[model samples]
Target: MECVFCHIVRGEAAAHLVYEDRAVVAFLDARPLFEGHVLVVPREHLPTLTDLPPQLLGPYYAVVRRLAGAVQTAMGAEGSFVAANNRVSQSVPHFHTHVVPRRRKDGLRGFFWPRGRYPDAARAAEVARRVREVVSADGAG
Candidate 1:
């Protein structure tokens, strides 16, 4: 199946584009969390963040960072929420980052879902150690 984001990237689908360049494209979300919500995607058809080539990482994030500030300024928002779902909660498979304008007393909670604290300090330390071990193994520590 053809990805909808790919169509948008190729100009095969309609989207309210806010920014576009050779490497990335930014457009308004059809169903927004708030009024100034935008979605930024790579021009390529990479399915997930892990699939994105290392060479494109810097360029991709540069656009995302710019869009974060742009959205906040354009919408007169006090802040912004920038995030991307890898695969689990991703509505579209294409690797895309959401930049949503934010303001105080916006009614939105910490996250869309409930939050929980770690069972204990030991558990938190154990989890951090496990993650750090993997990062070190990957030469990313």
Candidate 2:
């Protein structure tokens, strides 16, 4: 299937990219549920977590953890949620992790999500690179 997330991973679709490396690519969701909601995706485009190697899982979730910290610091988010929707709510048909920056009253109620607007590209890129660096350095350490 021609997945939109794959295109974003391939750079065919313009995304407000926050992070990228040989193993992963992360960017802001175009229609986000929160201001700094980001997606951490594998470059290889596995369709589900079950398809990922057990070893790869640590690095993958590591990326998510680093970004969550960045999201909290950068966006002043009070809290956050990270998830991967496989059978029930996978919108892109590719294995990707969502790192959503949450505040106390962001109105993200019980997984009944709402679409939030995308930020400016320059700001997004800056945030993305910062997040990428944080995750990359942590991965290296």
Best by TM-score: 1
Error of 1 at 107 (Å): 1.5
**What local lDDT does model 2 show for residue 98?**
87
Clashes of each: 0, 1
- Would you estimate the TM-scores of all the predictions? 0.95, 0.74
Q: Write the residue-wise lDDT of candidate 2 on 81-102 in tens digits.
A: 8888885788887898888988
List candidate 1 stretches off by more than 4 Å: none
The residue-by-residue lDDT of candidate 1 on 20-136, one tens digit each, is: 999899999999999989999999999899899999999999999999999999999999999999999999999999999999999988788999999999999999999999999
Residue pairs whose backbone atoms clash in candidate 2: 18-128
Q: Give the CA lDDT, 0 to 100, for residue 42 in model 2.
A: 88
The global C-alpha lDDT for each of the candidates, from Candidate 1 onward, is 0.95, 0.85
